[model samples]
Target: MHQWRTWHRPLVLFAAAMAVMTVVSGVGLLVDDRVLTGAAIWSKPFKFAVSFVVYALALAWMLTLVTRGRRTGWWAGTVVALSSFAEMAIITAQVVRGKRSHFNHATPFDESLFNAMAVTVVVLWAGTLLIAILLLRARIADRASAWAIRSGVSLALVGAGFGFLMTQPTKEQRAAGNLDTADVIGAHAVGVPDGGPSMPLTGWSTTGGDLRIPHFVGMHALQLLPLFLLAVTALAPRFVRLRDPRVRLRLVQVASGAYAAVTALVTWQALRGRPLIHPDGATLTAAALTLAATAAGTYGALRTGSGAHTSPSAEKELVS
Candidate 1:
């Protein structure tokens, strides 16, 4: 309801496309490898098609920003979309070429290529996050609505950012020449010869033991937590004078705390030899924080709203 007229259509389309693609990808996963005679050829088309849809959706979303004076954000998002398209195009091309290891092939899918793709996607997504933050900071939108929008933007970008990183071969794996040939590996494969994961589990590698897994997981929380905060803030009583100031302070507190907590939890677990995909104490802690923040924000907003209901007397006094 808050400025849904701005970017609602594009965002909805993007969400729908993403949902459909997710189902498609999931179904593809269920299809046994041996059954598909042309697995790569048939399998890859879905992804490629999904990739184009995503690209178009992203572009459309950016277009919605022109009214908001977000030229920079638009361009940044465009670049990320382009990079993603490039990645998918390359993978589809490899599949078309009958490359067995479409993901991790040392030949065409080399480290440099991966590095470029990773950096571009990461930077672009991060850029989107920054733009969302800036949008609020610039006061281009109402405080309550801006907060919600920014939080959603941050979460989606963070999720996508780590997703990009997880697709690439790790530095250590590349250095040791023990990289996996396929982009997605099953759970039964042998660990890296020298001491890597036998198989990639939910995009986490046992071999290099990088922070990729936790990072990806942490980024996803950005969506739920921030939106919850925004919602609560929106429903709160309008402070006659200091409402904006108070909301801004709270938003900063929540965002900073959540970011730090997630980062710490992820880092600690990864360093302590825990894999990212597996549920553990640290991940649970992060989840708790996210839930707690949402609850607190909701409760605070209700309390404020309740107080507003009783403020007519004060308003009469001021009027007199």
Candidate 2:
């Protein structure tokens, strides 16, 4: 069992840095009165800092779990660490300068910084993909944990890619024809302007659709799915059916499907310029169907585990 001491060094250090930034930014939120794009000026730094903490720490521990390709995984982890730090630095710098970080091209300098951020994002994606490959080829001991890790990485990639959708110029931006003049280009909000009323804290669009919603949901699947698997494992003692490895794996598959559906659903909703808080009939119906399907799938998986493959003693030891 590899401990934190043996986890990826660069990633752990990066996570530690981000943890400090998280505390600093959180304090800034309480003291600073500056606002950016209808949110507190410190908001971007705080959110990004916290995200890096979760991502870097999780990635560090996960790479330690791999039995194969440790060297390649180390390189991948380093790439992710460096790129993550670059992206966070840019955001924090922009925040301090009273400027927007993403989708901003008001000045030639800002455009250059944004371009750099784009490069970092591409590198981050590639690095994550390589890590996924390592995880896929690893000789994992637990089937449930393996499935969770693999499926989580797959969904995370899909989620992170959706961020690119926001970079395309909106119809209004095209019609306004201010792109050449170095006006702001691209936006997170679909129907409304970027700086309109937003949800508290997260700064998510309230008046119109926001692409960030889906992007966020997708990216955190890497963490959420694994946590879900852990919860199931923890409850195995109470729920006899969950004691089986096969049942847990099947549930992970089902959850992965459901998670992907949510990502796609929110994406479709946003692209259609509909606010998440105000879902129409189509979205509601689709959500209902997804929930029903997941319920049925869970029932089926539980039924299969009725005839346990191993004795109770073996099952208890396996879970423990």
Error of 1 at 299 (Å): 8.2
Off by over 4 Å in 1: 1-20, 32-68, 92-105, 109-116, 119-123, 126-130, 140-144, 151-212, 229-256, 276-320
lDDT of 2: 0.88
**lDDT per residue (tens digit) for residues 1-320 in model 1:** 35545653533454455557556655655662432222323354464455446434543443454445466655655564555556554554544455532234346555455456556566656656655654555542344444544554555555454454345444445665645564432111122322244233243445434454445445444445445555555654665422333444355455645664565566555555455556477568777877798568645643443444335554343323
lDDT of 2 by residue, 1-320 (tens): 24779999999999999999999999989999998888899998999898889888878988988788899999999999999999999998998899999988888899999999999999999999999999998877777898898888888888889888888899899988777884578899999999898888788888889999988898888899999999999999998778787789889888988898889999999988888888999999999999999899888878877864667677555545
| CA lDDT scores, all candidates in order | 0.48, 0.88
- Worst ten in a row by lDDT for model 1: 185-194
Task: Show the colliding residue pairs in model 2.
Answer: none
Clashes of each: 8, 0
TM-score of candidate 1 to 2 decimals: 0.54
